[model samples]
Target: MYKTLIYDFDGTIGDTLPICIAAFKKAVTPFLDRDISDEEIVSTFGPSEEGTIQALIPDHFDEGIHAYWQAYKELQYMAPKAFDGIQELLDDTAKAGFQNILVTGKARTSADISLEQYGLTKDFKMILTGSPKGPNKPENIVKALKETGTNASDALYVGDAPSDITSAHAANIKIAAALWGSIIEPEKVAALKPDYTCRSVADFRQIVLPE
Candidate 1:
């Protein structure tokens, strides 16, 4: 029954966490004169490089962002991959007339790289990258829905983080917690009580593209 599908980028559609963690550590270590712990990096990282830079090196924000990407691209081992079944899910959904939107915390350039590398650049009808202009996911979701002429009641937002659940609720849209990504703890995601939960893309396809 859903006419639209909104997705989160990093942990939802692709497995970019490991690469991002490694890249972030490499990028920020020199500035701090010490390596940041993985836990700290995960906690501090947000939807964009600017946010991460601001949190760690506000004085050298622009330079920090440049460093981050340079480190990211150089880490050949950290290349991202689309999760199994994701491409099929996207194709099926689009074929079924569902408007797809990508709402991510990633900067435009990084997001572009991810989509292009993963061969998902054309899957989404609209891609909303991270920006201070309206960094709130709920606001971005609402904007995407409006642009597509889809009502919140007729759409579902799919994501792998607790923030995604909260934002979807705030936007008055249904949310599906994607456990296959596991970016957030499973128990914690359950506590958030997203409208639906899918352990795999196959499970997701059943709910969104049910026969």
Candidate 2:
């Protein structure tokens, strides 16, 4: 049985796509003078805010990145919601004696706002955000394992993006790719060959805590 479960926040636990897209639009529209489509915004879902801004607006990266995060935070503060069944899954995992951690590319402040807004502040044993000091997902997995006093072999990292799967693979932790997320391509997730693929939050519970 898994002793710890580390999750990615944005597309994994929290359904913040609408807020994210709105923020991106708010940040980019003035500069581009054109409305960005939701599909374009959704396609850039996985990376850090800075990374996303840099990728989308390279010329004004320094200014645009800051603006994007500011707008994103403002929007998120007013519109944060947990994914369907996330609370139940977290409760179930806790009941089964598994430690939960949230490791994400979002800044700690933003992550805190979302977690608190969605009433998930107490769900995680620790919340690690992306920073120069903080390691990436693979490294974070090791840190979480050490902090929780668990072995990689006995832990699972669940997420919705390719990077999450890659990081789990790098850390040798079992992975569960969440299909009901921003990545509209299960084929892409399948190509990563995660230890498991969950069609929904309920499916995930069944795998993690089978009857």
Candidate 3:
């Protein structure tokens, strides 16, 4: 059994669709001279917010990223809701002697607020957020293992993006793709071929961590 489970926050644990779309729109409006559709915004869901913003507004990547977070923080505080059954999954995993850690591309301040607001703060052993200088998910996963005193083979990573699977593969941790979140298409996730694919929190428990 996996002793440590690392989670991705935005689309994996928290339903951040509203805030994310809002942020992207707010960040790009001034530069694009035309409104960005929610569909366009939603398509950028997998990457770090900064990276997404950069891709959408290249010349002003830094500025747009900063502005996006500023707008995002104001709106997201009230926007996030935990995915149904996630709380129960966390509880069961904890009871089964697994340690949970959150690794997100969101800034720490915003991530902390979201976790607390959704009552998820207590569910995780540690929460890591993106920094301009911070390492990517793979490096962060290695750090997480060291901090938790777990070997790579004993850890598993659950997330909604290709980046997450790539990071887990780089870190040599098993990967489980969460289909319940924002990815929209299973075929997109299948491209990564995670060790496991879960359609819901219940499926996660049964397929990825069966007793």
Number of the top lDDT candidate: 1
lDDT string, candidate 2, 1-211, tens digits: 8889899887788767667678878887777857788887666655566666666777887787678768877886545578789999999899989899998877676677688788998999988777533337777778988988988889999988777888899988899998786534677789989999988998889888898
Evaluated against the true structure, the overall lDDT of model 3 is 0.80
TM-score of each: 0.94, 0.84, 0.82
lDDT of each: 0.83, 0.80, 0.80
**Candidate with maximal TM-score:** 1
Off by over 4 Å in 1: 76-79, 132-134
In model 2, how many backbone clashes occur? 0
- Candidate 2 residues lying further than 4 Å off, grouped into runs, are 33-47, 55-66, 77-80, 132-135
Candidate 3 worst ten-residue window by lDDT: 42-51
For candidate 1, lDDT tens digit of each residue in 1-211?
8999999987788878777788777777777877688898777755476687678777877777888887766663555568898898899889989898999888888787788878998999999888733357888899999999998899999998888898899999999998886455788889999999999888889998887
Candidate 3 RMSD computed on C-alpha atoms after optimal superposition onto the true structure:
3.1
Tens digit of per-residue lDDT, candidate 3, span 1-211: 7899899987788777567777778878898978789888766544457657766899988788788878877786645578888888899889989999998877675687678778888899998777544337887889999999999989989888777788899999899988887544577679988999988878888854577
RMSD of each: 1.6, 3.0, 3.1
